[model samples]
Target: MSNLLKVIALLSLTVAAPGQSQADWQSHESILGAILEQVESNLRHTGEKYQIDVAPLDRRLQLPQCDRPLTVARLPGTRDLGNISVSVRCEGTQPWSLYGRAFVRLSKQVVALRTALRQGSLIAPGDVELVEKDATSLHGGFFNPEDVIGKPVRKSLAAGTVLLPTHLTTVKLVKRGQQVAIRAQNTVFEVSMAGIALTDGEAGQRIRVRNVSSQRIIEGQVISDGTISVSP
Candidate 1:
């Protein structure tokens, strides 16, 4: 077993009094284990390292043996680590329920700005940095350097500000400096040319495209990530 798991296992024997009889009462150890499992399930594939600690159940409570299996779940709106409330319910012959508390600390390196930037300013290599933060404190989504660098800020942000997808505006169709296929079509025939994108392009937005064959630049509407269609 992992050191962390071993420690938590050792704690299972320490709760209540040493000689206290738990034969007739609901097992507090099992309840804590269930909460840990639920949190681990949620953290799977998240790429964040975490630690968990659950409060020991009160020894004075006369919790009865649950004839059926216990059901455990994190309460609504309490999914984001830190301090969380969980419900442990028994639906056996004599129904019973109790609230438990646990703390989850999740950590990950996220992209943030090194200096304050104004809205619409393009991000440069020196403008951004990576920092470790509690993943639980972040809402929505976070970003990496590659996701934010060379992109324009949607609004002004202060130094050390973490970057989220909502903070940046990027190519939905075409990106700057990328090769694009330009197509022109008519009832008689159709022609296509290779071009270099001069700026990011969006649907119905005008963008400059440089034709590789003629070495001439023309405007076109974005059709796809690598395709731009022009009017004849």
Candidate 2:
């Protein structure tokens, strides 16, 4: 066989063959073979650590179990590199392995609260704040207090809201350049409130529609027109 196999065989013979009977030697060799196979497999493979919820072995586990992605605190080394440790966690599920794939417990961070304050950009529990050093550099500047202070921040921004610092900084409250739609087709029209009117439109939502053809203003559902209608 190969040199490694020969070496192991000789070593096993020296350690156990003399002390045990012939049958015992055969059994030990079989175990050695299995261990060698595992070593060889590990040599050729690579792995990473992921925390996931594992189902208990006692229960019937299902495939494609949706689990939260774990926050990776550390990473493993390459197949032939540094001191790597494949990390895995167990979730509420137990046992973890069916045949080979097992669910591991994992932890995730979520942004609970977010706002721009003069002190710096405020974030909730899991939000990660990235800081850059040079503004002119390709990475640009870090999240600064001036950038977020006095800026409208959301307690819970929608999925559409960009979380990146660059994108959030460029956002502004709709003011003069805001585009408004008019609604006139529906009878249940309403108008903006008196104090809340951003423009000339009255607040409290009164139905108002302006006919382009006759240049006449008609009162209707303020919101039903699908566009902002004016009082006629």
Highest lDDT model number: 1
Off by over 4 Å in 2: 1-49, 59-104, 107-151, 155-170, 177-232
TM-score for predicted model 1 compared with the true structure = 0.58
The residue-by-residue lDDT of candidate 1 on 1-232, one tens digit each, is 2344334334433234445476966777887787788777887778778888887766545566678988888788886578877777778776677677788899888898999999999999899888988887787445568776777899999999988889988745788999999999889888998999999887668899999999899999897668888987
Q: All candidates' lDDT scores?
A: 0.79, 0.31
Per-candidate clashes, comma-separated: 0, 42
C-alpha TM-scores of all predictions:
0.58, 0.18
Give the range of the ten consecutive residues with the poorest summed lDDT in model 1. Answer: 5-14
What range of 10 consecutive residues in model 2 has the weakest lDDT sum?
94-103
